[model samples]
Target: MARPGPRDGALRPARRRTVELVLVLTALGAFALCLAMAGLQIDGRVPERFPLYVGVVSAAALGLHVTLRLVAPWADPLPLPLATLLNGVGLTVIWGLHHVRGTDTNEADRQLAWTVIGTVLCCAVLLVVRRPQRLQRYPYLAAAGGLVLILLPMLPVIGIEVFGARRWIGIGDFTVQPSEFASILLIVFLAAYLGLKREVLGTAARQLRLGRVKIFSLPRMRDLGPMTAAWGVAILLLVGTRDLGTSLVLFSVFLAMLYTATGRKSWVGIGLAMFSVGATAAYLMFWHVRQRVAIWLDPFGPDVYTEHGGSYQLVQGLFALADGGLFGTGFGQGRASEIFASDSDLILISIGEKLGLTGLVAVILSLLLLAERGFRIALGSRDVFTKLMLTGFAFLLAFQVFVVLGGVTRLIPLTGLTTPFLAAGGSSLIANWIGLGLWLRVSDSARRPAVLPLPTPAEHATVTMRLSGAHTRAAENGRNGEVSSNTRATPQG
Candidate 1:
């Protein structure tokens, strides 16, 4: 068999920018249509801000697209478009709810402002980081920052407790969910630390055996510190904020990065066991946890539905979903506003109510595609830290989405997790956009072609003679300064 020439190794042209532009345009069109349909359904006329809304969203998306072209031309094209579509859908739902409730809050306008801010932050991340692996240099610092952010909501002056969960910090009239940003930072720290220590945790471990079969690998006692610390942090989150959702998310992402780094099923089993124990303890100790469990079990019961901290929101969301049927009630229709938090935690229910089962499926599929692209980037990455970072981010999105959708649909106890890209929160939007930027940077590195160094003419001649075994004794002797050769010299081993 013949080896291929240099032409065979040439890199293919990157079509990322073109693909991204088309998808962005499509997303913009869909958003415009959603707004127009809502306006027509509500008042038999288009909304006055329809064009302006489209223009603003398009400009924001275009700015990000252009930034990618300049800094990360080989980045995956799917995430940006998928995120744009989800954000647009979220805006449409917020707009529909505002109109239906006849509220003067201008939620849609506020969301648009957040979208602009998030996009700018996304661009800033790309410009500053340029290389994802650079983050590994400050793992401890990242972890500390994450811990501080998570605990910020517990501060006396800034902490804002809403609906029994103390998860946000208030600056005058503005509120920010610190946990959202904290989750990403924590994942960054986990990826770096786990990637650096995977070999010891994976191989330098004792094997647990049953008869002749090895059941699982257990890390050394000394190696157990990181996992124990993570578990402790999760429990602290649950205890401090009464926020079971963020605790679960943080712990789940840690478990995922650990597993990715080690390639061991044992880590997953151990992580789940720890989570089960923690959840049980939480259920026993916290009234909120028990209430959430009760709500999940029987939200429709009169006692449960009407009691303080009962399942009123959950039941309303279920009813809204039931009303939408298969094809939904169409845009600007349905009673989504009847449910509280319809634009945030219950955004999916709002979407299901107005767009029905079909649109709901489409939205879910888009999220899955975004996740798929992130996983693809992880798979292609050659650097361990980069791979783990991408994997952790993907798992974060997956778990957060599952928790939100499952809670709304009664598959699990309701938790205070917001749907990514589709939920109405500035903190979540900024965090997700930053995550996207990191993924893009990693993907660019993974997809870029490797360049091989070329040999000089004399070196090439030496290599040829060495491969041909054509060196005479004099030439071999000349290598040690015993003689000299004028024709050619053989390469040394």
Candidate 2:
């Protein structure tokens, strides 16, 4: 038989890889179908460069699968497919919006380009970070980098003010949301810090008492440094940048990870309480915060709706959803293009309007599944840092979805936060893809089969002597079978 080439070996279709291929194809087909539906509903024809959209989606999806197989072969297959489906949904929405508005195709094309960039970065992370546990070594460095990212938008010359929030920075003609990437770095720092201190924070706390009745144990003040720092960071975001969304997300994710590490439910309550105080202070202090709350309370109000940059987007988004009801308005049949900021903060509203409640639920369920898979991956990991880091990514994503969806649905006050994998922001997409890469890395480690190490040089010498002795004895006596099995040593190649 001829030898198998290295290329053939790399391209081998194992069981999980096969499953991934089927799912990726399924996701791509669904997106193509949606694209076609949008085209026919709007312009009474197939979309311009229809095959190109499908091709891009297919290439990105397949490329991710191949990368996973080559680098993180033991990773769970579901995440890649799940994220691809969500990304496809976003692309379909973007396409529908552009077509209905009769805008140039560059916006969606720009989004597609961003998707490719994000995927490439994701693959790069997988290639670079072989042993994710090593990330624990640079908690401070991660913290510094994260702080810089979030704060960069506050710089006068570089910062770009969109509406009132200053959470973005200008790079030539492009604007980047620094907080999106900042969240991941902060999560990395939190994971590393909590991994080291979980035992002490969980079990070594001093118990508190209310006279006769015992209250909860109090964590030592020194032990509470990370918590305080996280709280300060959240408050700074809220107060400095007027970014309620990022502040809430960053703080809430940290709290969830903290509770997971410590197994202390009280920490959640404490974190919420602290966050509430900050929120109230911001509401009292910042007019933008007050306006958001007011709009959330009554989006249909005449005064608020008519006001500049008020509830027009929210009201329009709600009306679009009402139009969607059970089934959707059917692709491009509705006026999603009329809704302001429909691509980012209102992307869910776009889904709700076009795909209707049923499709909306499907998308939300996809988010839930992705988060579930991430948590499950964290649980499968043996290392504490891996567990916390995976949990942070999963929780951050889940909380982000919650906040954005709630805002769109009027369940909570709206703020500026992009949907992961399903929004049009390049920085957010790239950051999330990077996080997804980390998830795959840790999952691969968790799922990889246990491999025993070869003997050390000293142990190898001892084993060699035993083997030689047994062989000589058996040969001299001409009784190989008579050699004691215990005395025989087999040295592995």
Candidate 3:
């Protein structure tokens, strides 16, 4: 037989190449815009520092992309590229905020350096995680590690307290939030746990009888135990540590992932019940949560908060958002960065104020696209573990987006959580990049062809015999009578 030509081997489906090119270009465009906006924002205000920083970060991100293309050409076509662009945009916004505040650019420099470090880490994950099934071997260990990380910030005096929340652990000159990495670890645990329990959860039994109605056994209760534990931790964080928004978002993340895994309505009901209980408890015990509830209920009411009481940040966020109106004040032309800590957690309002509703919608749409593509990756995957893992990651992104955007717009009470990829945080950037990398790996597996073992002599003989029988049957039919009733009744045709 003539060998297949190199061109035949090289020819890939056009759709894959198109997706790859589109993502690459989109990432470049977003990165370029971010650089332009940052430079424009810092014009004559700073000592010409951000330009070099943006240059270095941009180069590093591009280099990572090139390396991935060379090393894993079939990888998920979207996540890493989109993450790079979002990270660039985040850095640019942070740099702009620094310029406006006249603060030192050292933080901005550190952020850029971390971006490089995080990109390297992402590459490492891509290289290390060669298979999806490998993660299922150590669920307990992963879950324990995640729990330890969440509790680390509460250890002695080593943990740093910021904004009344002990979510960070300061190491040397760098501060890291263990909760961010912990979230990823917990996600892995959830995927493994839920994937295994999905069958059990799918089976239903009667629990109680009332008249003609009987209560179906919470078959999903087995699956809900870990999530309930997660909810308890989140509630503790909300009431004790005053981080209500993160807790709410985390609950949503777990619920969303669970829903995707089993498509169970009962899980949603259980999550909602837990959320309601948590919210009521939080409102009763925590002054901050109570105050937030008040602000959320009556944000625009007369004298809603006493000057700097509860509604100050929401008030300010609203003012900035309203000021942006429709078309916005133009890039680098808003007053959002003048507010304290605006660049890190409240950067969305800053972007809204400068770029107007158009920019805000653009960012939201981009995130939606990212989440949609992530879910697409998950759905396309044949491996159950990969599907669950990818879906869980996508759930995290969607939940985070809803939390931050809802908070900024006062659709929900404001939380201090930073936006993923777009907000300035070392832990968040690192974790998000690692996640995007894993997503890429899953997507690659979805697209790549599996290698089949070559047939043995016996197998070859079987195949030959089947083909020979088919030929002999056809010849016999041609030589003998035409199609009979039995042949007509056959299903092959």
| Number of the top-ranking candidate, with lDDT as the measure | 1
Order of candidates by lDDT, top first? Answer: 1, 2, 3
lDDT of 1 by residue, 1-493 (tens): 2344454332332466788889988998899898899889877899887887899999999999999888888778888889999999999888888887887547888899899998998899889997788899999999999999999988888998877688999998889998988888888899889988999888746788899899888777888788888999999888888788999989988988988888888878888899899999999998878888988988887778873448988887888999999988876677788678999999999999899999999999999889888999999998999999999999889888899999999998989899999998899988998888888889888876665567778988999998767567656766757334532475667
Which is superior by TM-score, 1 or 3? 1
- What does candidate 2's lDDT look like per residue over 374-491, in tens digits? 9999999999999999999999889889889889889999987888899887888888888999998898888776655667889889999999999998787766455655346656
Measured against the true structure, the TM-scores of the candidates, in listed sequence, are: 0.90, 0.90, 0.84
What stretches of model 3 exceed 4 Å from their correct place? 1-9, 13-22, 41-47, 207-228, 236-240, 300-309, 456-493
- Residue pair clashes in candidate 3: none
Candidate 1 TM-score, C-alpha based: 0.90
TM-score, candidate 3, is: 0.84
Off by over 4 Å in 1: 1-14, 307-309, 452-493
TM-score of 2: 0.90
* Model 3 superposed RMSD (Cα): 6.5
